[model samples]
Target: MLNEEKSTEAVSFDTEMSVEKAKDAKKTLKRLIKLLFNQKQKIIIVLFFAVVSLVFTMTAPLIFSKAINVIYEGIKNVSLSGVFNIKFDVIKELSLLLIAIYLLSSLSNFIQQHVMAAVAQTLVLNIRKDISEKLSRIPLKYYDTHKKGEILSKISNDLEKVSDTLQSGMMQFITAVLTIIGSVILMFSINWILTLIAFLTIILGVAATSIIGKKSIKYFTNRQESLGRFNGQIEEYFTGQMIIKTFNMEEEATKTVETSNSKLYSDEKKAQFITFAINPLIRLMNQIGYVLVAALGAIFVIQGRLSIGLIQAFFQYVDQASEPLTEAAYILNSLQAAIASLERVFEILDEEEETPDAANYKTISNPKGNISFEDVKFGYGKELILTGIDLEVKAGQKVAIVGPTGAGKTTLINLLMRFYELNGGKIKIDGIDITKLKRGHLRSLFGMVLQDSWLFDGSIKDNISYSREASTTSEAHQAAKLASADYFIRTLPHGYDTVINDENSSISQGQKQLLCIARAILANPCILILDEATSSVDTRTELEIQNAMDNLMRGRTSFIIAHRLSTIKNADKILVMDKGNIVEQGSHDELLAKNGLYSDIYNSQFARSITAKAL
Candidate 1:
């Protein structure tokens, strides 16, 4: 029973912190590259443009150096009193060429940015599309195990991180690498001694950043996972506020959320501090490299080992070499986080999907209301929930299943609908093995009204019509009328079109139950399973709905799992189940005569009703 004895798995901080950094990060990065490489043409174009921009940028410094030497040479040769013999035409031409080079570099940069932006959006779109399809393929059992908000965070938070990295982080990383490479080559060509001095300090900064980056991966992984854990608590508690209020446990819920929030804050703070801490240190080292190059170049100029023009060009190269690292500190940080998020999304995509339907699967056009469970044995895991269950219901029989909590009543229904596959048994519908039939068609034969009423963010008409896509508005209204929900629906604003969601308080729990019943009525299946379907409705409304359900179940094979034994007195047969086995089976009168478990339970309920009325 979904309502009782719920033992749920909580999101634990210790579990989130245990993410395997070395193994998973490397694997995730490899997969991400493979996914990105699928857009081979787009990547190639972006790379080509980025390289072109780097080439143009590198050439500008050299031209400026040549112009500077020309001016310096003219100054040295001329007397103080005479006109300076600077090669004005040559300097002017070099200046113009440098300007053109800068313009071209900017243009290439713009083209790459534009193209990469498109590629980024396309990559995430394809990933999100695949995720959407994968969601439909996963089995219902997966949902039972995972938290709602954790799963939602994968779609919202994790994907957004990936999208952001792809959009800007990727482009920045590419450009930064190219800038470093081009600048180093130009610096070496100008003066190897100055280049060596500048590169030593840069290498130090790079080494430090590398060490820090490796250490931050674990924290980044934990922070993202903790974010998912926090989201799970918020979603669970927010959605279950009514239960908290009913049990007067508001303070408890708040404390639980506060614990989760504190963990998130701690993780986030550590992640951010470590990620951004590399920036200032990198800048300091690069600044030292700049000053060392400047001091060394001045000595070389005095010794006539290098010209003023060459020293100026070497300074430009050093700045360009260090610039990428200075900016890339945060890009590297974001890239690490994005890679972690990518791993989470991939984990979901790689989860085992539901069993596939056989080729040319059979279908039942008009199923007779006969269901037989033959020596059925099943379990969620290794331990069996339903053991050696054998039962047969003839066509048009109204069967009531009476059981204590965890007695496998709902499990039996789940098997009949094939929501979970059996471990060692076969179930047949109308003498045909259910496994041979198409799963969708097999499930379509049964209509279900569970205790927990499910309504999405849609209109009353939409919710009712969900069972049958082709059902018309009039058909929906007719079904609603039969479920005894038509009158209250008409009283609402916008009537059948009023939207339903968690925020809406106008629709009562009884109304939600009525809507679910209306949906089942619209399905109009040959087999009906009502697991405490009328439990939420008031006594008077339940009576009216019961009368309506009896008419609807006239010829349909129905199974009712009810808590109020008075409601099932007229059932065609009553099966008393205990601890996953049927203890006794008979009509209501026969069971009462035997004075078995069913009788004792019925008497207890009767006593409760009498006592309540007397009070």
Candidate 2:
């Protein structure tokens, strides 16, 4: 008994140490408990049925033992047919009672499992929905720093792990604990000495489990991280498969995948080996305990200090008591894996979301295209991308921004769209500070077309009409015609009805850009931001796109970020930037006559084109 107490204390200490080392595991467990607590009513119902089922299950062995005792006594004191018939009648009654109890126990178990499954699924659904909503609210910086594949793995794989654990592990854990307590009580009632003996031996098994479980936890955590890395690599490789093939780096990509896979295998193997080791050691201890109990019970029976029924009951109770301990090995492993997954999920949930609007925020119901950046300053982290800027544009004017790569060209557009908050200064539209306006309302005033054209799996009409909630076929056709995409689109088998599952698979890059431009044309915002809008097309296609853009920019304030100086030669004003500052701003002719940075860039491009034509 003293050994058993000390052993329990050791296990407790080990558990505390493991938890201390794994702060994330502890936090995740607490969060999961909080989530479960929200389903109190369902949990209470499950517990009720589980307890009832456990009672019926535990009591059956006692009744069976009693029946055995009765049979033994009857056979030993056989007198005649009259005695035998009376004993038989009593045994028959006990058997019927046992059968009824077993049926009730099974029914209770069924109900408990049914209710738990429902609760688990509901919890999973809500979690997934919350994650989806969270993705929208989180800052764009989060996506920039994190991989899409890793985030997706947490949403799908991690949540599935949590769901599986909640469904089976919760009920199993509750039942195991109840069974251990019930079995212990019955064992003591039969014989306190044997009960003590059983406990002392089981404590050894528990101690082994605690030690092994502690060592395996780190490996389990590593396995989950490796899985995330592996998934991320797969996503990157698949998305950039064309680049890899072009560079002939297929072997290198395979090597990268294999490295991640090998790491996962190593961690998984360690965790599983340690977990599987516990069961056999426990089984060995259990067999040893059975031998001790039988030998002691037999001696006690010879001295008439123990009854045959109790000896039989003790045998059954010994098995029942140790069963939970053996199953604990498996349960602990599953829970560790689930907790690891939960930590990843909670990490995302705990991230700082995008800044929300203040109380009494302004709304932009009818916005004019006038925009101003007053001494604006911004950065990624601590390094400033745009040091300082002051710019103003009137409605219906075309402004061009040109700079070398990484001169904060894209960063300017990002700030305008409110994808990233400015570190300092203010951006205003029509004399109202945009910082005071609701982001959704502010964004609705502008339309954008980028170099990379994005279209999801949908029909051509659906993709073109995506900007409007309801657009007629004729409206879509007009938008496509304006962008010069109608000719090729109509050449397809189904015309506007043709589905575009893979944008690059069927359509050329230029055609994809045309479709994007048509979508933007359909949106028809008061302001337009075009980033390398015609860079993907050939010269002929570029001319068509420029003509279409000219029509689209008729009365809209437009900001064009372009590398090809020829494309923006007719802009109302061109802002030449270098090192995050606008070096010069003027008409193309004025800048050219000035012979400044813009002139140099334009002259170089002209020289290159002339040289190519001569060749």
Candidate 3:
């Protein structure tokens, strides 16, 4: 008895959860509809067509009903010249009216479908643009956490589903409701008793739809989630294909993909099965309703309570009623799927964006790049990466930040660029608080070269001039020469016009870095940031790059983050960072004499280069 009670309790808990979920689903559906219809001005054209289609659909059964009554009346009273005259020439007139009704219905349906298609396309285009704009405003951390494939799924698959709902499902749903309403009124006019029976069948169908629809919605949500995961896994695997081969982990990679694929397939199948069941079940119930209506109508006619014409019209009304219920079942399933997609899209759009502070400050006309960080504290989250990093760099002074891996050197650069806000203290440039300056104007003053050199799929010339506007060919060539990239660039078959594919092409990593340097040089910013700029180059290439860097840093205040100590040995000041704190700061000679963290790192790096040369 206790076990039975426990089971009952568990079932009751599940029931309550299911009810809550259903309520949430309804809310989500309503929200999605509101979003779709909010662009009322743009959607009015499509709505007009939808309304016309619905009216025509509703009138189709009525036309047939009227024709049946007219024909019955004509047959009841035959016309034979002087012998007899038909009360009304109902057959001839009804035939002509039926033809006109069908023609009008066809024309309206054609126009409605065309308008709906146009509306769906337009809405999809606008939605994609809106998503893209929203993504641009979102913080970088959001992209860092999300997978590329998952984002793509939202823009592609989810948007496609929304389009499907708009183009077909929405129209079907409207027409179905109108048809149901029309059929019900006509049925009541024919026989109230049969109308009551029809109502019971409809209610039963609705109940079944509700039960199956809940399961369908749950499964569809799961299916979309699984698809996103599957896409993410596939993207990750392909991105790391080289690593998998080097590690001899092909089988492991395959297994991982297989597992993800299996989960996706299972979820999809389950959702499809549940959604598919709705229409068939509704159709079965509809067929039963049809049979009951026909039998009862025949009985009424035989009892002399109903005319033959009235029975025929009643049968037509039953079929019309059943059609809408059948369509409603299908449309409800489709609508549930669309809601799943819309929810995912909205999830991204609703994410918090980076908020810039409300402060307008004087624009730096000729920024001298005098940077100061006073007791700065920052971190990714709870773990503090930078603590009390007090530092200053005079105008045009070359500052080098040297640190062990994960010692918050890059975090400092990120803070300077305002990519992440500092938890404590202030960063100022030219005696003005950076937080008060517009990010766009502030970033425009800095030329940054990251450890990983990124090149878009475009011509070399295009890559070199990827700033605000296209650079002149002569200007691009000059920048390339300053970066020591012009020599190899000219040797290529297409030279500056040679197209490079995404992170691919026969070019070496050193060449890619040089190209990136050229890009930064073309921008001609007052402040330059070189982060492991020559880390991938050989000794000869490094010397060439060092010369290029010397030319680039001639008139600019530069911040160099280098693992190679020799490159920054001549810096005006060297700051040694350890666990988010500036433990030591001095010139190269001064730091060497102090024999601290900076000295140790410099010696280790210099000795390694010497040993490599000896070997």
For model 2, the superposed segments whose C-alpha errors exceed 4 Å read: 1-22, 80-86, 502-504
Off by over 4 Å in 1: 1-23, 77-82, 87-92, 246-248
Query: Model 2 scores what on Cα lDDT?
Result: 0.84
The lDDT per prediction is 0.86, 0.84, 0.79
Query: Please, what are the lDDT tens digits per residue for candidate 2 over residues 40-132?
Result: 899999999999998998899889988988888877886765565238887999999999999999999999999999888998898888888
Q: Rank the candidates by lDDT, best first.
A: 1, 2, 3
Per-residue error for 259 in candidate 2, Å, reads 1.4
Whole-model lDDT, model 1: 0.86
1-615: candidate 1 lDDT, tens digit per residue: 133321122211232434554447888889888888898898999999999998998888788888989988898899778878999999889988888888898999899998888888888899899999998888767777678788899888999999988888889888988898888888888789888888898889888877888888778788888899889888988888889999999999889889888988998999999877888898888888888888888999999998888889888888888879766777887888898888888878999987787687888877888889899998776677678999999989999999887777877887887777789989999988888888888988989899988889999899999899999999999999999999999999899999997356789999999999999999999999999999999999999899999999999999999888889988999999887899999999999999989889988999998999999
1 versus 3: better TM-score goes to:
1
Measured with C-alpha atoms, the lDDT of residue 163 in candidate 1 is 91
What's the number of clashes in each of the models?
A: 0, 0, 1
Question: Per-candidate TM vs. native?
Answer: 0.94, 0.94, 0.90
lDDT of 3 by residue, 486-599 (tens): 999999999999999556758988899889889999999899988888887788988988988888888789999988788888888888988668889989999999999988
Kindly provide the TM-score of model 2 when superposed on the true structure, using C-alpha atoms.
0.94
